[model samples]
Target: MTTFTSLPPEITREILQYLPVPTLLAFGLTSKNNHSIQQHSLSSLRLGVFHSRLGGMISLMEATADRSCLHSVQMILPKSECRKKDKVIRNQNLRIANVVEKYTHTLRDLEIACWELQESAAMSLAQLKNLKRLSIRLDHPHTRFSGLDPSFWETAPGSPVWNLFTSKKGEKGKSALGRLQSLNLERAGITDYQLTKILESNPNVRELSLRKCVNLTDKIFKILAEGKVGRKLEVLHFTRCCEVEIDERVLDHIGRLLNLKELSLYGCYRLDSDLVKKLNDEQWHIEDLTLPSTPSSPNQEVQIDPEYK
Candidate 1:
């Protein structure tokens, strides 16, 4: 009577690849045979910077080699809502780059949700050439969701992170993120100027979301509508950006987007849904428009067409 681990190494490796991280990790603890399989198939990793330690991170990074089918990598910080200490957060922020550099070859989707943008770590983004979906959410506990505080948009010197990939002419050569597709910067509190520079850099982007960014204004959307990248964008999400007061002019600009499929603008009281319906003179290929839900309204239940999905 032979056990599952008694199978050939190649056979065992193929079977173990389909298991989830926890199961694969558990198998590794059972026997040395399972450890090799776990090492090879360890493609994706999701861990909180504060919840885990550096030694564990180093071990995982070392394990990810040519045999490892690395697919996605996410390195997120503890949320500000949890009331974490500043010193702890700062230390974690500083160490993110060191941990990430270990697996630059395997990285694809990268997300960094923190109270403040880790400028140092973000500067090294160019190294991750295969990164496609980038989500950078910077939200503080005290920062109002309705509008951005002045301090959050302090980019007079310009953000090194924003400059990392956007510039065609790097000090050395072309940086990473040339092939990026989707970018979401919800609640980063970036101003129009910084947004403009970022858009200018990533011209091939298809999906764009700036949800809950307090400092952003209509200017950013206008730029998006008219720019080269703006034309190619298929999905646009500007939800809860109360400060982004858009009128018919702005709507008209957005209406020109030829490939826009989904438009989400929940909590944007300033924008008129009626105008959004009527402003389609150019006949944009829009499929769905998501708005805010209100119990006060007579039409309490708004159902999106199931076919749209």
Candidate 2:
């Protein structure tokens, strides 16, 4: 009598294709046979690694040491985990490093939410040469105290986090981040100069978002308006980034982003009412322009989906 495991490889591939990503992940963890089939059948597999799931994630990584099935990754740390002692956070970073290093060849999209990334894990992340999209969400006061310097670009040699933002120097000058197309950072505490370095390094990034990045000033907008990223940038968001003075000079610079399709400045209170009107009046290519309500108008700020179009 034939069994499901004994089915022909082509039949198994078809069946696995019908299953959703979550189901495939669950079934892959059930046995070696299912894992093999899942790996071969799916072009890419999604992995969600949380503090609670770290042990199981590590075990799976050990079991599939030779395989590179995980493609998209979301690593999130809970509030409780963030509040843990430094030793626990360090251990967690080590585990994250192991998992990231193991799947560098296949991992493409990564979203990390933690108090901050330690150097070890950040270095491991920089090794993902194929990474195309990245999101970093850091908690406020904790990040300030965790020795997480925002000027990663100017860090010392073997600058783990800086490596993620820059291209490796070689004959080809290939960078792990050369393929990046979208970047999002929330509460990053990065200054304009630091961010300019990042943008200059990843000129291919098409979508850029900065939320509560208090250190940014008009200088950043000036860079984008004149930098390589502006040539290709299609989406831009500046939520709660109140320091940027979006005056006529900055507005003119923004108009130079010929490819920009969407623009949002929600919660950026320093915005002048006339600038908003000017943006609306300009004959630009922007398809979506979202702005915070004026002080006279007590309404909610317009919200846009973070996902790129």
Candidate 3:
């Protein structure tokens, strides 16, 4: 019988990648060979870093030192109230800064959720050179249901925090996020101007999801239709949002996205049959579509186009 130590290094590393983090840590203690395999397996991982401490999801930034080789990192925060006394929340700003400084050059996908704007985290985020997928959720856990102020969306271009991820004037080769393909913003206080800047910065994005963002307005959709931003978009989702009304014309404009395959609009009470007709008439390419379950008025019912299967 062959001993585990006698196995080839490739097989050892492959097996290690699937092991639970605690188990992997335990294996790392067995011998020098096991430690080397564990390090190799962890360096190339794609991790979903949730706020919860469950299952095998360990914080990549906390778990490894050389995390630059990571292909994906999803940072999630609980929608429910986070205890103010928790060390995770208190030291989060410092941890985020360290992670970004350590791995900015090779980082790909990044997802961040902050109860409030921490300058350190914002600055750290700007340093990522190869980020492809970015998901930002910026609402306080305690204030999820409270109405948001409109002025929160009006961000100035000169703001250091906003400028970090954007191209400086006349300093262009490619976008800071040339590799970006997907973006998700939830309750992030995004205004038309800020959204335009982000879209312009990452023009190649194919999938966009905006949820519970109260600051986005109809004019933003108009911009998306008229500008180059929506050209490559294949999937779009807007849910539980205010200020952005999904009227018939908006749907007509969205139909221009030739590559669109999935369109989901949930709790946008303003949507009606007119929007459905436009989607149906234009031969929209959406293969999956979702609409609000409850119409604004008791007499109205949402109509889904049969062609979109």
What's the TM-score of each model vs. the native? Answer: 0.64, 0.65, 0.63
Query: What are the per-residue Cα lDDT tens digits for candidate 3 across 1-309?
Result: 998889998888777766765687689889997776766664333433234543114333323223343344444545443344243443455555665665566456566544333556666666565777776654333222223344433321123344445653346643455557877776665666767877887788888898766667677677878777687788888776744365555766776777778887776767774556456556874788776545457778879999998
| Candidate 3 deviant stretches above 4 angstroms | 1-90, 139-163, 167-175, 244-246, 295-309
lDDT of 1 at 308: 100
Off by over 4 Å in 1: 1-47, 50-84, 140-160, 167-173, 280-282, 292-309
Which stretch of 10 consecutive residues in model 3 shows the poorest summed lDDT? 55-64
* lDDT value, candidate 2, whole model: 0.64
**Tens digit of per-residue lDDT, candidate 1, span 1-309:** 988868887777667665765677788887786565666544344433442334224423432122333332334444452244455446556766675565465556665544455555665555666667676655333333223345653322224456555543346545446667878875665678867776676688898887667667788778887899888989888877775365445676777787888988776777676666655433654788775432257868888998995
Report how far off residue 92 is in candidate 2 (Å).
4.6
lDDT to native, each model: 0.61, 0.64, 0.60
Arrange candidates by TM-score, descending. Answer: 2, 1, 3
Cα lDDT for residue 139, model 1? 37
Writing each residue's lDDT as its tens digit, candidate 2 over 180-254 gives 788887666677766776777677899998876766777777788889998899999977776546434566777
